[model samples]
Target chain A: MIDSIKYKIQICCGTMCYIMGGAELHLLNDHLPSNLKDKVSIEGIPCIGKCDTKEKHHPCVKINGEELNNATSQKIVKQLLTLENNDLL
Target chain B: MTYYNNAVITKHELLVRLIQLLDTNKLLDDIDRIPLEMRPRTNSPIRCCVHKDRAVIKYKLMALLGFNIADEQHELTPLKEYAEQALEGYTQNGNFLTVVDEACSSCVQVNYTVSNLCQGCEGRPCQVNCPKDAIMVLNGKANIDHQKCVNCGICQKACPFHAIAYLPVPCEESCPVKAIRKNADGIEEIDFDKCIHCGKCMTACPFGAISEKSQILNLFNNIKHKKEKTVAMVAPAILSQFKASSAQILNSIKAVGFDEVMEVAEGANMTTDHETNELLERLNSGATFMTTSCCPSYIEFSEKHAPELKPFISDTPSPMAYTAMLAKKRFPEHKAVFIGPCLAKRTEVYQNQNIDYVITTEELGAVFAALKFDLVKTDDSPIVSKVVRPESRGYAASGGVTNAIKTILSSEHNITTELIDGIDKKSIRLLRSLPNKKVTDASFYEVMACDGGCINGPVNVSPLKVSQNKLKKAIQEIQSEEAAV
Candidate 1:
């Protein structure tokens, strides 16, 4: 079996997101399945430097490539489902 | 974007970067260039210019390195100098909280302003309720003369349309003990004697002027000295934090150079058992009511705001203290560093001879990142399961202490428990009211300054609900694993 997951998820660990919801999102590392774990490279970035831009709702996350503002644990988990269920990786 | 992202995360990322540099032995050469490189001249300015932003970052790095700004005067010395001073083994002071005076917004201290929403009504109740006659209607709107205003706040109540608003300085309004007040220069200063070190103001400040003095460099230096084994005492609240299993977290901690990870919950089990016995003895011995002193901030509150209740507080050392004592006892050659989500734990450990250091979950997260330990790829927490009872594990949440005490105290004792989930002005007042010598009907009061206890502590990087769920799952897994035996 071979698994090559190329997802690079960067969650904003910036203070605004930290205070708003980024702190909660840091827990994302503990929830993903082990199979998906090998594929996804998750990191808490200093910040994407986009906080408060366009009055953005924070605890933002970049999944694969697209940034999702106002992200929650459930939303992130849902996005990870596809990557996790795949055994082919 | 708001400066908050830059204000808060910039400091943390910078600290992590410093640690990463140190891990790679590049600290001395590359550290100074961090702010400069991050805010390069070509980049649009965060402040008036990149140079100004870099200047603020320098003072911030100083604080992060556990040194206060050379105090209200003298141009800042270079980051290299502070790094040298830290390496020269300047021990940290008891004053753990410090304010960057330059960052202070020096916001005007005023209360109950009449806004444009103020209806220029003929009734003029704002004027009528103003005892100082501070209110005057002009330009078809109510205006408050700041000099004449006593801040009585009567006009706020008098306004029918709620046009009058109360503007509170973030740091001043959030301090439960009123320890922070502005100096003549308008920069906020903390009265250390009154300050509880709860760190509410740290999160409340928009300017991020408030900061905890760092001890990470000191810890690394301690490890460098090789005086003793570096024992990591993991708090009960830490089990499910950061989405890492207890095994992974423990191994990751070991991966960071800790000789071993001792469950603070093991000490908590002892604490819970000992505290319960103390409560039963106190209640049976005809004490009217006893308070749990496990929370250092609660102890500070009792000593400062409610000295009358000092006699009622249990003399038992807190879980952190007890764990440090136990850790020291078990391994005489060990230097215990408590890892928890509490900021007050810093103040608590500074006085404790047994505890060598106090690092928060946020700080530990930085260290983990600096070392680049990926829990997703690492093994689960290498902890021996069932080493701690499930009840003691409940120490992470509010009411957990009372529940643990209740498990030990017989129902025949007829103990009435009062649980205070959060401490604020109102709760402090309520605590003060207990000493009236009036007809009282309580055996124990469990007070957690932070709502949801240590899980919701000031510096915990995880969400409470998520942490709680993980805690619940971990406890169940422990119980079931034992059942499998």
Candidate 2:
């Protein structure tokens, strides 16, 4: 069951994002609960170009292609929990 | 690790906006709109009101424009006038720091206050511990007498109820030299003679009241006008700053309008060689001990606070100084810019003739944001050098200097070394006491003002642990590549 379900988490490694708190989001793996450990895969991607938009939220993250702005470790984990709950149902 | 608080975010936002305006040649025309734009009427106020918030932003922009708040000739002077003056080469009088009085929270004087939890207990330790008899039992609670209290913090510790609270001004507490204090208006003021420009106060202020005068606009103006060939001499600490590789970051900096990029680590090699010789010479000549003079803030501290230690400071030039010299010899017509995570370097540049400007790592991030350079996607521009030592690259972390010198002097002599990781009140006292102590154990002393060295500098972007891990990995990779060759 763990092998069948995997969530994709792409953390922005852009300069603006990295400085604005994206760097800490890279440590989301360490922060994941035991239940969600094998349920998610994290990768760092280059700038997603959201910094130039009218709504300026930096250090962005994308979980399963859903954009998360002003990303933090706890916020990402909370989103992951919801995603995992929906997928299990 | 530095906290990404709202103050830091606002500072970066202002920098990016100002640089963006300068890029499109609309800075002078739209400079005044920045305060209003950042604090529109619709948005809730960050301070007391929108007007106060806008006023603070305006003063912060003035500092970003390289003008001190004290430089304003009139109350209604627009930011565009400051921008105009900056473009016209108005000198900043070598002052790198300024206080945004509008933003200053005017924190109350540092003192101990007895909270309601104070029980006026049977032990009465608070009354007993008062050196000045400042503590008294009022009704059923303990009270501190403001008139007699010296703020020694004895009663705060003696209270069994743990009710006494010590309130401190963060900036004053962070300063090593006691350089900043509350003025008559309660706003903080820095004594230039006492300040070594370590920038601790700038980082410690929760309100972001202290600001460094930025040279970003002046640099942008030069690059845009093609006034002179601009060469960026990046410090070794930069390798740990970004997530991308060193080559990619260098290329990205080139993309930011620098004509040439030179690694200051190359100059660190020169420092190692000269310092090794100086240490050997001093040791052989029967001198007690010698300290490394690489840290600009440490050097300034020795000059202003510890004058007697001057004779023991090594005469070897810092990596920045050597790199700027090499830059001048190679690019005779270029204006050399030393890019690093240091505020004291601005003061260092004022004394050194070869270097023309200094920019912190935070300002560099703003430049990248304004230009919208994708760092990882940028083309790799590897440094072209005959010999690049891994030891020189290690100079970004604490004890790296001693390790480099040890590698060279290991076989010849068994020299003892001591490391002063960071400068603070306790470290200052130790440093001052060093001269009086006889028969010291160490022959070499390495002093870094910022704990964990330049990678953990006040203006650094990345976390200290992240930087340390990255730097270790990068150095190991360099060692392996050298081994393969």
Candidate 3:
């Protein structure tokens, strides 16, 4: 069996999020470090209801459940870099 | 219960069984979401264009065992290598124009909003209220000058008779943008400049007049050449349509020509994880009320009518978009087509660089018919699995969002979450009527614009009311199974 878990990033694909640029949310796959490309999984979602709170602040996404704001490919890459560094640490 | 052993069941056979179970109630629900008035009575599975915007299609094909497969996008494996193929050999129009005619007669107007303004002024309130001075006195009645009148309904409101009416344009009314208009011939005309390609109007039109230029012939030619593998990502609501378990649905889709079948629901499960984290952070950082941007129509509405709310839209990919990434990751060599009950998905797929094509249930049926292949009668010798995450299955209905959030928060801190679906003025009124402002009470809220969830999408094969009941049954069945397990 193939190990489904590796280096993967999941994104919410809910309609609300897609309109906020969720449709192209996984464009970040291009920005992944070449060494980690095979391990990375960028995905979308329907609705998680996280941003559905009374006070919604977004362009919101998560990497392994760690929240990131002003999410873009570049910002996500940096977060991954820190995770890689922490694994060594 | 028509029970077929999983080991012997082909995906097509499974699908045939499912389709037979889909009666008028289910068909009505599907038609309601798709906004289809008159669909074809094809000998095989039926497919047709849902006239809302830019001619997006809805398809319901007979799958293995008489199951119904409804998809917004078709399998795109055949279209990957258009450069090397002869397009003429494979091109065939299913008398596309004829399908549109049958639909026009039965198309009923869906009143999203009605004219509340009756220009109550004495000097023909429509003329007095006309901002452009476009109204003229013709035969002592208000007549709008075509050149100067901007189609703004101020005159309609000003008229006491409420005689000045905003007649529903068969094709252009459902457009997310004000892109569609009438030409000199009274036929619908699309303005590319303002068109966002949402395809809502394609599903809205009664005449089946608005349609997308065909890329099917090119796709068929590519398949003949065999350039890439086609993978189809089906939406969660579709799972309810199948009489058998989810695994059988996967097998049927595979039988339809998909190399691999994956659930878009997994994306829903993952989104819950991503969005919840985002919510916690945003709340800590100090932001006021936030609205969901998941529904494409709502998002487009905010962009055109409520741009101020853009910042509030949570940045998350739709389940389909998320699943597309997973498919690409798992099978990098394959081109993906999303199959579901949504016309907006056509525009969403076109706009997204990752996805290849979006064919509705109607288009899928057309493709199956074109091949003279009956998915229901196909041999049932395919591998299938029954495993689906509870969260994944829960993503099908309107309140599925709330359930996922609730499950996630069950073990966590005490954050209050409230789910709101079928959001309209009435729902807003209920929220406002609360004693101490209910909107502030919940840590999270899920709102779906449609009265029923996506099962009633503009491209589904079931009715909203029946789908709602089915949704309840499916959910309860799942819950009881979980409890028993």
Best by TM-score: 2
Q: How close is every model to the real structure, measured as TM-score?
A: 0.82, 0.93, 0.52
**Where does model 3 exceed 4 Å of error?**
A1-89, B1-166, B175-177, B183-187, B191-198, B213-225, B240-246, B290-293, B299-307, B351-353, B368-387, B411-451, B469-485
**Interface DockQ of candidate 1:** 0.12
Which runs of model 2 end up more than 4 angstroms from their true locations? A1-7, A27-40, A84-89, B116-148, B480-485
At residue B474, candidate 1 shows an lDDT of 60
lDDT of 1: 0.76
Task: Report lDDT (CA) for all predictions.
Answer: 0.76, 0.86, 0.50
In candidate 2 chain B, what residue range of length 10 has the lowest lDDT sum? B380-389
lDDT of 3 at B446: 62
Comparing 1 and 2 by lDDT, which wins?
2
Candidate 2 CAPRI grade: medium
- Which of the predicted structures, 1 or 3, would earn the higher lDDT when compared with the native? 1
Estimate the Cα RMSD of every predicted model relative to the unseen true structure.
7.0, 2.6, 22.1
Estimate, for each residue in B63-144, the C-alpha lDDT of model 3 and write its tens digit. Answer: 1111112211454412112212323322222111112222233332322122334333456767777798987665455556
TM-score of 1: 0.82
lDDT of 1 by residue, B230-304 (tens): 999988787756555666667777777888778777877778878888887877777888888888888777777
Candidate with the larger lDDT of 2 and 3:
2
Which window of 10 residues has the lowest lDDT sum in candidate 3 chain B?
B1-10
